[model samples]
Target: MKIPFYRPYIGDEEIAEVISAIQSNWLSKGPKTVVFESEFAKSVGSEHGVGLNSCTAGLHLAQLALGIGPGDEVITTPYTFVATANTIIHCGAKPVFVDIDPKTCNIDADLIEQAITPRTKAIIPVHYGGYPCEMDRIQEIAQRYGLAIIEDAAHAVYTKYKDQPIGSIGNITCFSFYATKNLTTGEGGMITTADEELANRIRILSLHGMSRNAWTRYAAKGAWYYEVEQAGFKYNMTDIQAALGIIQLRKLEEMQMLRMQVARAYSEALADCEEIILPHDSHEHRHSWHLYPIRLEEDQLTISRNEMIDQLSEAGIGTSVHFIPVPKHPFYQEKGYRMEEYPETEKVFESVLSLPFFPGMTKEEVYYVADTVQSIISKHRR
Candidate 1:
């Protein structure tokens, strides 16, 4: 049996919502987007939500809304997608990299204070692989430093830090609805915040900095006259994507249960494998299980991670690495970032591989992948 890395669970409900949206004739950012923004915000216990084209846009807008600009530094983990750091560069701000906690693969809050300088304006903590970072301590640090917090929650839409939802904690939280995300709108994202003025600013910044969006400008009771408040980019979510988001939001809990089941099954099946280290789980925080990244104890095996990946592919099992560590990338390297600066991140990247994990994975498929992994390890045991 072949198991792909991920497959989104799109049901008839999503199809129906898309059909209804298309039939309405308003395909751009319209009523569906507005309703999606409201419902998603409410679900996450945030006061406001602004739908955008991608989570990258939300991150960029969050920095812009808080006036993070040239010479400003935003602290974030080197263990995440480059988009997390690229957004800071887009604003002409410097991205200061921090090493991750070896245990959680999230930013090490203990190291944050030492990285902060007078020019530091914000912290963008990423919830890696749906596991939340040490937010309480991060918040305390941010508070003491008077710094804004923009959560890179691309993998954490359903995550919670202690009793607080991920979206409700930070100054502005961004979520992705990409095709492979836990909750998908094909290619969309949302920004959530309790600050009303910040929400309004993000909304304006997402759609060309217009005083009013197309929905309001062309409505029967609206007028054509408007103002461009600031120079902004075109990053509005289309009605078609929001239509999918609306239905996806409704089915989120159900889909999450399936993902949890797959995660549980993997842990149980691989518990006896000495060469594999499972992902961390904590009762204190809810993990969204967006990616089931397992670290291979390479010292216990003769094969390298790349060799294991090749063996898995030959077995018809697909896998992927979570990230290459932002500092190791060519662009970041040219910008003076070095891998040695983030030892933990580089260590994790060498062994980490994301398994096939999605909402609708079959029990047989899960076991087959797990069994194949064990077989590979058995053959290569040192």
Candidate 2:
């Protein structure tokens, strides 16, 4: 009866792959990592992929590859994980926050124009909760403004916009392979881009800016001497993580189907509840269904969002909130980001709740979660 918010879908295949990686005795960035990068690029409709230790690392490197640094500004939505904005700061650039669309909870493309300034160098739009942002419009803005598009697609592994994969649309797209993500390598990420030059730069930067990686320099046919190209951070993915990534990538479709099924079950079960506002989906885009977030109509319910979460926990059903709006965080607040400037994000944050969702959840478990949520709402209704 105890249902956790997330559990990685690892199977015998993943175990075997890890074992094979162990047998190779090459745990650092090796053959498996290279193959994972290639296969992942193909899966996302991108020409190249650079594996990294975390999505944050990929985002930081993306900004660096685009020459974004001191005195520059990057526009992004406030209704996302802080990493979206933190990455901009990591590059010694300022993060310009924009409001979100209430419906999709993604960055509102209409509001982007006003945020642009002379110092603007990039626009990092997050595909929030695996829902595709208004990419076409965002692209038009980026093109007209001469800004780079670095998509924060951590929650959007298989999402698509206008029949094009998410990874292929942005100038550079970052994906997460965290334990809770749709596809996982426990703690890893990948950056994809169609530009080969950018890919090469990212590769070099991901592994400490060395001219050659350990795998290459130590190989039989490889040279022992290599130059230090640039001062880059240590953010390389290991062979063990890549092995897990390969198996997870192969099972992605199968896992996605189950995720969709759970999403539908939640939607159908909660459709009749007036106190609940379900997440949006459209025919024009493919959502990865990574997180099934629901909003409470506070007017109809006496309990606050926090109380509702507590009630769910009491019912043995775990839950989470997607985000708290970046501006509301102490770091951003101290940096002069005002919550009032992002009204939509602030409003959404107060009511949004992510239910227990994952590929491993059976139909019965899905319904039980729905029932628990309904019971909590009914008891709290005014």
TM-score of every model versus the real structure: 0.99, 0.98
**Which window of ten consecutive residues has the lowest lDDT sum in model 2?**
211-220
Q: Which residue pairs clash within candidate 2?
A: none
Model 1 C-alpha lDDT versus the unseen true structure: 0.94
lDDT of each: 0.94, 0.92
Top candidate when judged by lDDT against the true structure = 1
* TM-score of model number 2: 0.98
After superposition, candidate 2 runs with Cα above 4 Å error = 212-214
Candidate 2 lDDT score at position 201: 91
Q: Residue-wise lDDT of candidate 1 within 159-273, one digit each (tens)?
A: 9998889999999999999999999999999999999999999888888888856457777787788889888789999999999999999999999999999999999999999
